[model samples]
Target: MSRLELSPNFSDPDAFYAALTEAHRERSEADSERINARLILLLANHIGEQQVLEEALSIAAADSEQPR
Candidate 1:
């Protein structure tokens, strides 16, 4: 099982952020939420690794408890 790379893995993080944010442009809350859900599932499917996805889910759940 491969481990999650909790580091700077994106080649162009800024571009990705821009694209993601742009995708939400003029979108309603519900639409944006659906977009996010679809994106997550698509990425997870691409990864095709249960262990890594579980690790990511655990980290995300833990992070949600943190104060922003």
Candidate 2:
């Protein structure tokens, strides 16, 4: 089984967030969503593990219902 790494693994999380926000800045909602969808697909392809990706999808869906 693939190990799920639940950690702050980014070397520069703030920079990544800033870049992501900048990509969405001044964009229409639909365009922002397209960017998100494409990004997820690209990253999922990079991961290339169906089981791990499914686990991630489940975790994300569950987390979406929780209060931040």
Candidate 3:
């Protein structure tokens, strides 16, 4: 199985972030949450790699305040 790549993989991360924020603009909190869930499912499906997804989940679950 391939290892999860932690480094910057997107060609335009900031642009993507801007677009994502734009998508949530003016949305209600519930609507924004639904949008996020849908996006997550779509991306996870596109990834289509069990191991990589699990690793991503583990990393995401880590507390941001604590050292890695």
Candidate 4:
């Protein structure tokens, strides 16, 4: 078995955010939602706010586990 790893190259946060927003606007609704989600994760990672990201993930997980 083999594993693959992918990483983002974001030299400038502002530029990346602008590009991401533009791409999202050009995408279909579903694709835009997915891109938005990915952008959140990527931006969080780029900001080096691991604690905030972890807390957000935990909250999301907890919410998903609860009944509607």
Candidate 5:
């Protein structure tokens, strides 16, 4: 077999995140948004900021229960 190479198109972090969020929103399968929420939390932890992360978690939790 010949070697194959794959590359991600995300040139910037912000653009990558935006694309991720959009894709997450577009998913129709069950639990897709929940997966996205986990991803968001992971990214937030990576970025640091206990206060901001807490605030973001609060907002997300509040919105998760509402109609989309």
Candidate 6:
């Protein structure tokens, strides 16, 4: 079974966030969407596990559909 690592895994989360924001800076809405798509695909590819990826998709979808 795939373990959903619900923990702080990044050594420099702040720096990673800064870089992510920087990547979106000066980009149009469509451009930002494209970047996000590419990032997701790359990360999913890195994971390379259908079960884990499917679990992630389900969790994300469920969470997003919930009332905040």
By lDDT, who's the top model here?
1
lDDT of 4 by residue, 1-68 (tens): 22211245457979877886789776799999888789777877775666666766787698899988
TM-score between candidate 2 and the true structure = 0.90
lDDT of 6 by residue, 15-67 (tens): 99999999999999999999999999999999888988988899999999998
What are the Cα lDDT values of the candidates?
0.97, 0.93, 0.92, 0.71, 0.69, 0.93
Evaluated at residue 25, the lDDT of candidate 1 is: 99
Candidate 5 residue lDDT tens string, 5-68: 2245456979878877777786776668678679877887685777766666677688899997
Error of 6 at 58 (Å): 0.9
State residue 25's C-alpha deviation in candidate 4, in Å.
Answer: 8.0
Candidate 2 per-residue C-alpha lDDT over 1-68 given as tens digits, one digit per residue, 9 for 90 to 100: 78556887999999999999999999999999999999999999988888989989999999999998
lDDT of 3 by residue, 1-68 (tens): 77888888999999999999999999999999999999999999988999999998888887565785
Clashing pairs for model 3 are none
Clashing pairs in 5: none
Report the CA-based lDDT of candidate 4 relative to the real structure: 0.71
Which residue runs of candidate 1 sit more than 4 Å off their true CA positions? none
Model 1, residue 29: displacement in angstroms? 0.2
Cα displacement (angstroms), candidate 5, residue 65, comes to: 1.6
The CA-based lDDT of model 6 is what?
0.93
Deviation in Å, model 3, residue 65 alpha carbon:
7.4
Report residue 56 deviation for candidate 4 (angstroms).
1.2
Deviating ranges (above 4 Å) for candidate 2: none
Clashing pairs in 4: none
Residue-by-residue lDDT tens digits, candidate 1, 1-57: 699999989999999999999999999999999999999999999998999999999
